[model samples]
Target: MKKTILSILIGLLVVCFAGIVSADGIETGIYYEVDVSFDDDVEPGDSFDVEVEVTNIYNQNGTYVDIEDINVEVVIKDIDDSGSDDLDDDDDIDDLEYNVDDSIDFEFEIPLAVDDQSYDIYVTVEGDDENNGTRYTETFNFTVNVEKKRHKLMMKEPVVNYETLKCSRTTEVSVTLWNIGTSDEDVEMTVYNTELDISEKSSFDLDAGDDEDDIKTRRSFVLDLADAAAKTYTFYVKAEYDDGDERETEPFTLKVEDCPTEEPEEEEVTIVEEPTTPVITTPAVVEEETFMDQYGAALLLGLAYLVVIIVGVVLVIRLKKR
Candidate 1:
């Protein structure tokens, strides 16, 4: 009976020790659960958000235990030929009570050089028990799908010959379109300014390739500002491809000024007058007296006196003879 009682006591002691060891060796008192949310269709060279909902259910010794110094982090693994990136750690969560939950957002940007493939995303949650200072960590992972559009058209910045234009003048505007998609595309380019009532469009085919010359096409247009006002005008360049998809460039500005005033021209006048006839006049004639006309009158008076004297002499001669 003594040996049986000793064996029974040894068995009881072994069971109690095992129980104590099992209770002390509990891996964690904090439970972690996560819910992830993201976009279904992801693309390269795009910025997106990944929302994570974290819940903590703390239970220790049949009692609720609070956790403190909580931190959350996120990392995106590299895909084929793509690079990896890490989000900043969110350590502002000081403590979490039993059955409490919180949400975090991780903003991510895919590299422009990434390929069309799936990538892995990792989320880690770490904290410590407030009572015993035991560290607890949990990690969760998910996948993100990345794909590129089959037909994508992009417009480069427009090359304008003049930023400021004069009224009744013209400007040359040129732009280039790029086929950055996976296949060849037929592109339609348009440059327009609704306020100025100016619109121009052209169509061309572009071969899809990585080379700059292979995938790009250029077009030029001359814009007449004959009826434009003297205020600011905005121009836009748009590209349409693959039957419905389109892209537009940033707004370009062109300022118009009023044309200068022109001075009036003076008229020339010619004066003409008929020719005048000259007058002619004749002078009167007066003859001057000669010397013989004056002497003829004196000679006639003397000859009359001489004839009377001769007659007296003849009478005297006749008286003497008687």
Candidate 2:
């Protein structure tokens, strides 16, 4: 047992040494060629898609061996700086393996978040060596722009008016959408209320227009309000076009007002060949009066006395006898 343990430890050291140390400085049967295709100019805060293909070009065990499976990771650096030889984060690389049945190709996805005017993306591919425990590393570089992070979702009627029992209420709102992608593409949009619980915002189809109206997408919502207050409800609009997607547009709030409800129906009774009594609605008394109303009413009362004086013959006779 001791001998077996000793043998395993020795083997581990040998493997670890073999992984990074080659007379040629880490030679492995696995090789990677990474190619990227993206929009030429990515605008600040724009979005673009990146596709990476890693081809294995080598042979193993006297047989022509191809990289069966490998995972590639991407790192973004300042345009002025080059990436480090060592990985920044351990999770930068994904674990991938090639099985006898699955030995064909290796693929992976990564996103580039553009925070600067321009940046460089470094891609690293790691794979297992069949003969030894050595790990083969391959790298590729690409340039990115802040414009690539530029993405927008436009809402025409951001604030929807909701109907209520009070007059002067409104709630239905509609909006138009656009791809805004550097390339012509379709995006999935999600809408949700931050304060109030609302139905999930659904996806809409948008395309970058070549002709008029080609870049526009139309969508609408009937925002509902149960209360009679003018409080604001915030909604979140986020879009994800495809793989390597991210979010934008911090949650924004929209003020909504209550809409008036429909008037009640009037029920009428019918009589055949006979006149029907009219439905009498009593006049509502005005309890609250403005200053002008009170002044006008006092003026009319004073005018009544003046009219009595003009027709004062009967009143004067009664007053003289008294």
Candidate 3:
């Protein structure tokens, strides 16, 4: 009976040792050492990289065991949110020989809405042993601190009442400014065109709030192109705030055209004339005489002489004939 009891105790001890070895993977010879590297001062709304180096360890028998189908994954856990991102190109290794080290890079972007605080980054390495096909998983994590900039300004696309303006005309230019930083700001907005020789400025205050209305402000300027020439003009809207922190919108174009000239209208005219009076002419008086009355006496005397001569000639001719 005493020998049987001792043998039973020994068997029980052996069983417990085997369970420990199996649980710790000492017998399977699939162990790994992990090293993670990253930046400590991570900012919100920024992307960072975490490099993991996984080294395979030999078994308890002092023999090298190959690991196959190795995969590395990474996740970020904040106070209120958690997310996982895909690893870089070299995220997995087909086979890792004994005592060899492999590395993978994981890129994570901090959400813009994330608070400025500490975040936990968890890295998991998983693989299978080639000889026994036993799967092994190891997890590691580290903390990252996030901070925000105190003076940051963002300018949205400017809205213009007229993209194409006529010369000697006025246009209304409006833009919205956002205070995305941590502190309130006194913003100075300017709308300028160098070629047009125009510069207009306005000032306002913005609160550092996450809401739309609290952190946003709109400003408008009346750009008078009265003296501007007719051509393509490049204009820029800039915001200056919070100790020389400046932000500018992308350059926008405005086409200024010559004002159209209207032609003069023709007018019809009517001419009025005064009535003319008739002119009276006087008649001239002249003495009137008959043609026969004036020459009657003279003609009678001449006729008498001619008759006497004719009578004499006739008598002479009659005597000669007898």
lDDT of 3: 0.70
lDDT of 2 by residue, 103-180 (tens): 122222222211234455555666766546467666555565444323443433343344232343335545455444
Q: Write the candidate numbers in order of decreasing TM-score.
A: 3, 1, 2
Off by more than 4 A, model 2? 1-30, 59-64, 77-116, 131-133, 147-322
Off by over 4 Å in 1: 1-30, 45-47, 60-63, 79-91, 110-113, 154-180, 184-229, 243-251, 259-322
Which RMSD values do the candidates have, in order? 24.2, 29.5, 18.5
In angstroms, the error of model 2 at 234 is: 20
What TM-score should be assigned to candidate 3?
0.53
Cα lDDT for residue 188, candidate 1: 73
Residue 40's C-alpha lDDT in candidate 2? 47
The per-prediction tally of clashing pairs is: 0, 24, 0
**Rank list by lDDT:** 3, 1, 2
lDDT of each: 0.70, 0.49, 0.70
Error of 1 at 204 (Å): 8.8
When 1 and 2 are scored with TM-score, the better candidate is 1
The candidate maximizing TM-score is 3
